[model samples]
Target: MTVILERDCVIAGGGPAGMVLGYLLARSGLRVSVLEKHADFFRDFRGDTVHPSTVTVLRELGLRDRFLQLPVNRLRTLDLVVDDHRLRLVDFSTLPAPETFLVLAPQWDFLNFLGAEGAAFEGFDLRMNTDATGLIIEGDVVRGLRATGPDGDLEIRATLTVAADGRASTLRDAAGLVPEELGVPIDVLWFGLPKPTDPPPPTIAYASPRGMVITIDRGDRYQSGMVVKKGGLDALKQEGLPALRKHISDSATVLATVVEALTDWDQIKLLSVQINRLEKWHRPGFIAIGDAAHAMSPVFGVGVNYAVQDAVALSNAIAGDLAAGTAPEATLAAVQARRMGPVRKMQRVQRFAHGRLARATAGQHLAPRWAIGLLRASLPVTRRFLTRFIGLGFLPEHVDRPVR
Candidate 1:
């Protein structure tokens, strides 16, 4: 059976970006509906580190105190380690206002929290387990979306449609949008380890043979990730667990001391992180945000944070335009223009960082006898290099100043 629903905005994919956008738009008195394919938010091992820039935005939205109260770990500094040498990057302790640091929390929990808060708003509607299948277009503008809900196929008409779906976004594909590849060659092996009784410093360790090991602390556990060349996991697995253990042990002292063998291989996940930017972010009344618009490599871990920022920017821009009685198409185009520069800059940085790491040769080997020694020697320079890549030194002026 076919049903029809209408709203001011229809946001597909109830991830961080979509949920936050819904919350903001609903708060502004616009009828907003968020369609999520999942029955609930219980995914695992997503981007968990909420950076300082994101925290600043959350505070501006009045969600910081409640967000901090959740089960999350506070990360003040990012320690960069290469064969034992370490450099502390962006000391949040030194940053002004709420101490700019990465707040650690599961992505699903955060999304759930935002969704519930959005529900309290007067015009917010959440439809879980409903999948958007296609677009509803009239002339050059997108009039709404065609979706499949529990009842059956339905048509949802909205003034604007937002695609916040992840990397393999169906909406983007359906809209005939293709991403421009930046050619990132690294693939990552991710796994969660038991929360350490006494966690080591928050660090990223790079080794000669084992590639890069990124360690993030969950409130009660630790999540570790290793990046290797594309199609590297098969070769690593062929080397077996003993070889893997030895490789990690040799590369990072912290991991060597803390990591234990888990009987289940299912505990480990492998992801291919790609860096790409869409040719265009909007068409008529429809727009794309988050991974759908620009998917960045995991090197800097700013993907989710940037997505949330996009949501904030889009919501504020559109809300302002609506209040002024501007045309929806004109408003969306303006928002895209405002956001395109920052998104492009971030993609460029990701491409550069991924290239450097992927193309590193033995000639560039900076490892010293002591792992800490190598880190100390390389980290200062690396910290400076990373400041730009991590969306710190070059934050967009519009993002730095909220539209209040």
Candidate 2:
């Protein structure tokens, strides 16, 4: 027997976007159901960055202090090694005091924290192990969604449906809303290496003629990612794991000794990079946000933050309308309007970074030495721009109405 349910809003994907949206809308006194396909939030190599923009949202929600209580690494600056010159690219310290640095926590821990907080609201329903398989559309209007839950098939009819299901969104596909692929030239291979007893300075990335490697400090282990040309992982594997190890070691000498920990090919995980966005974000009773709406690159680790921002913008835009049982297509389009500018700007930045990375992965320097020297000379100006650009992002959204 199919179980029928109804809510003010039904959100697919309990990621940063859906979870935050659910929390926000529920707190706004709107009945919200969030569907998570997974029983638990334990996905590894996911975006773990809780940027300053997100911190402000947390502050608005009165969860900032509690969020800080979690085990997290505070990154003060983003240091990048371009060839032989190590550049302090972005300095979060320059931002406003107290909540200046970027927070790096396990994505699962963040999601769990959010889920727990959202549970406090009477209207928030987070359904675990529930896969939102298809949209319930009736005559060009998305009525709700059909899901396969722990028991059996479930039907959730809602006033407004949100597809936050991620880049490969089932709902987005079902709605026939395709994202325009903004070509990305590089993909990343994620793996962990044992941290040395006397670790190197917390350098975030290293780029040279060899390739680009990201090094994240995770207490005992270095959560690392090696950037490769898009669709080049198979060739990299054909070259053997030893070649992979050597390439990593050569790019970032700090990992030379630790690269031995990667003895097997299975240790590496490939993240196929993509930058894409939907031209039209809404139909009649539905809208898409987060990765479902626009997939971002991992350039500045803004994926999580941007998704959260989307939720903030979305909730602020339509929480009232949703609570009143009518979030018209115009209001949904307005949410997209409020967010589309930032998304487009950031995607441009990501695409530019992708071009540079693509060239670097092909044994080319990121930029001319003169350009690097010029940037170094203009540190004061560049650092401030980067701090705001990466930390707060463009047109950062805030929670508008008081939570019920």
Candidate 3:
């Protein structure tokens, strides 16, 4: 039997975008329902960094201090090491007070935090173990969604339906939103090795002729990723685990002994990173945010944070309309208009950096002397630019509607 539910807004996918919007809009006193395909927030290989953009939102909501109690780490500087040369690329410490560094909390911790906060609001309704199957449309003006949960099928009708089901969004597909793929050449083979007993660097990457292996300090373990050619995971696997182990060990010598811990191939997750954005983020009563609207590359780990920013923009644009139960298509359009420029600029930079990585991985030698020299000479200028871009983002959102 299909369960019928009604709300002002129905959000598919309880990810950063969906959960944030659900929480904030409900805080604004709008009825919101967030559906998650999974039963629990725990997931593997999820984006773990909370960029300052989201941190600012938490501060605005007065949730930052409480949220800080969760298991978290700080990444103040991102260093790129090529052969014997090391360059500090993006430094988060340069950011202003109270938001100087990126918070490296697991995505589940972040999601659960959002879920709990949303639950505190009387207008918020969160349903887990629910998979959105298709959009509920009435004569081309979209209305809500039909989902399958543990209990049974659920039909939710709302003033606005948001597709946050990620890059392969069923709602986006059902809505016929086409994406422009920006052909990224790299795929990531992500796995974890034991964190070195000694103090580890905040975030470090070892780029060699074989490829690039980045290791982020995940408290007790080193969350590692090996960047290989697109569709290269299979070929790399065919070479066997020993070959994979050697590559990782070479990239991170401190983990040479630990690399043997990965005995089986299944432990390594192949992330086919795709960077794309929809030509249209909304059609009528439906809106798409986060990965559904624009799938980002893992180049800079900006996925979750960007999604958070999108939620803020989206909530700001349509909260009142949602409350009044008359969310017009124009308000949906405004969210996209306000956020697309930043997405385009970010993707352009990601694509350029992607090409550079591919070239560097295929060939030997570090970045050119002139390039390195330029980076060194312009450290201060570049530092401020990148710190702002990654930390606060292009257009940071504030809590327009805070619950009294």
Best by lDDT: 2
- What's the lDDT for candidate 2? 0.91
Candidate 3 residues lying further than 4 Å off, grouped into runs, are 402-404
Q: What C-alpha RMSD separates each model from the true structure?
A: 3.4, 1.3, 1.5
Question: lDDT of each structure?
Answer: 0.74, 0.91, 0.86
lDDT of 3 by residue, 1-404 (tens): 88999899999999999999899889888889999999999988989878888888898888988888999987788877776466687888778778877888988998998998888899999999999999989999998999999999899999999999999999999999989998998888999888766744665678866568888877788788988888888788789999999988877676777888899988999999899999789999999999999999987788888899999888888888877779889888888998999899899999988887786557654467687778888987987888898787777877785533
* Model 2, span 333-384: residue lDDT tens: 8889889999999999888888888877889989888988999999889989
Best by TM-score: 2
Which portions of model 2 show Cα errors greater than 4 Å?
Answer: 402-404
Candidate 2 is scored at a TM of 0.98
**Model 3 lDDT vs. the true structure?**
0.86
